[model samples]
Target: MLTIDNVSLKGINRPRLSNVGLSLDSGKLIGLIGPNGAGKSSLLKAIAGVEAASGKLLWNRQSLSAMNDNERANTLSYMAQDDTPQWDLTIEDIIDIGLLKKRLSRSERQRRVETTSETLNLSEFTGHSIQRLSRGELQRVLLARALVSEPELLLCDEPTNALDIYHQLNVLQLLKKQSEQGRLVMMAIHDIPQAAEYCDELVLLDKGRLVCHGQPFEVLTKENLAATFGIHADWICNKRGVAWQPRPL
Candidate 1:
């Protein structure tokens, strides 16, 4: 399990995460959802140990603070919201970088990269420079890089931001599959309906505070949506299912 207790960032005047806590187990996909500046990215960074945050983070009974850089790298993989490659490396090379910390035979590393590339539809562009790819392509490549690492805990920030509708669904399905394979996959996402459809759980944050969290049906209440997103849509539940359409203010 991944446990976070009283997690708060210190550098800022106010707490970026407040005294927040969460305990998540493997084989689960958690989606972090909120408006802009809601600390979604900050929370993801804290969980990835990339930001300076005061918290007790434990993964499978091991304290995160006690783990070395390599140890952390071996256990978790983080995908930044802005993952543009500066050096114009090839798709294969960027994917291979995910395994740099791992001790693997050259053939095994190649195998992993190739398999991940195929999974993300990057096989055809394996030798192409990242600079030559479009934004959506780059996003897929970056995700492939993160997925290739095979981390026990995967933290991704707005991973499907630049992708089209099809790719967005594909990525969400992939994350769901990863969790089903006994890995913990948490992503910061903005697409509420997609999150509602796919995530096992949803964590809603606002202004660095954890607003609400639970199953989609329980947490996405009309009042909660109004307070959190100013969404005054009519929420109707029928024999078919629940559905909501936004209304103009």
Candidate 2:
């Protein structure tokens, strides 16, 4: 389990995240949702140790801060909002980098790279330079790199930002599978309907404060939605199930 206790981050004179706390268990997909300036990215950054914060973030009873760089990287894999590769490395080469510390043979490394590339439908572009790929293609390649490491905890911020609807569902389904296989998957998402469909738990934030944390139905109420987003939604349920259709503010 991942436990966040009384975590807070102050920016200049403003508080970006204040007294935030939440616990995430394996086999659960958590969705972090909020309006602009809600500090969703800040919270993920704090958990990934990319930013400093007060209080504690513990993984499986161990202090995250105490872990060395390699230890933390081995257990946690984070995918930033923008995953475009900086250099002109080939897709295969970038994927191979994910296996940095592994003592695999040449054949093993090649096989892993091939498998990951195929999983993300990057086989055709495996030999091409990452810089030559489209925005969505680059996103998938980066996600493949993260998956190749096989970390126990996966944290993604707006992973489906550049992908089309089909790829968006594909990525979310993959994350769901990971969580079901006893890995913790936490994602910051703007798509509320996708969150309702894929996430097992939801954490709603407003201006750096935690507004609600619980099941999807409980946290995605009409009142809560209005309060957080300042928009009215007509929530409906049919044979296909629950969905929220937004109305004019």
Candidate 3:
């Protein structure tokens, strides 16, 4: 389980997050939804140990601050909003680098790379340079890289930003699969319907404060959506009587 205790971030005396507290259990897909500049990305960064903030981030009852760099890196994988690769390296090479400094045999590393590539439908583009790939393809490559490490917790920021509907669903399905397999998957999302469809729990934020944190039906209501997003929408049940679809506000 991941426990965030009164986590707050301040920049030059301004607070980005204010006394935030939340807990995430394994085998759950948690979506963080909020308007622009609501500190969704900041919250993910703090949980991933990539940002300095006050308060406690604990993993399994142990303080995350106590974990060394390698320990933290090994346990959590963070995929940033802008996951573009800067190096002039092939996709295969980029995926291979996710293993860190581990001394795996050449064949073992190749196997892992191949498996990850196949899982994310990047097997054909493994030889292509990252700089040459399109935005959606690049996102998939980065996701493959993150999965190659097989961390206990997966943190993604706006993961579906550049993908079309097909790949968007694909990525969400992948996250759901990982969560079902007992990995904690948390992502900051901008699309309300996507979060409603795929997430097991929703953490709604407004101006760096948590507005609601619960199941999708409980948190993604019309009132909350209007209050946080400043839009009115009708929340309707799907044909199967599960999940929600929001009409224009």
- Clash pairs detected, candidate 1: none
For model 1, how does the per-residue alpha-carbon lDDT over 60-124 read when each residue is reduced to its tens digit?
98998789988998999999997788996899999899998999999999999999998887888
Provide the overall lDDT of each model, using Cα atoms, as 2-decimal numbers: 0.87, 0.89, 0.87
Look at candidate 1 and tell me the lDDT of residue 55: 74
**Candidates 1 and 2, the one with greater lDDT:** 2
Question: What is the overall TM-score of model 1 with all chains considered together?
Answer: 0.94
Clash number by candidate, in order: 0, 0, 1
Across 85-122, the per-residue lDDT of candidate 2 in tens digits comes to: 68989999988887886677999989989988888888
Candidate 2: RMSD to truth:
1.4
The whole-model C-alpha lDDT of candidate 1 against the native structure comes to: 0.87
Off by over 4 Å in 1: 11-13, 235-243
Note the residue pairs that clash in candidate 3: 232-249
Candidate 3 C-alpha lDDT tens digits along 41-94: 999989887889899999999888899978887888888888766799999999
TM-score of each: 0.94, 0.95, 0.94
Lowest lDDT 10-mer window, candidate 1?
234-243
Candidate 3 has its poorest 10 consecutive residues by lDDT at: 239-248
Decoy 2 TM-score against native: 0.95
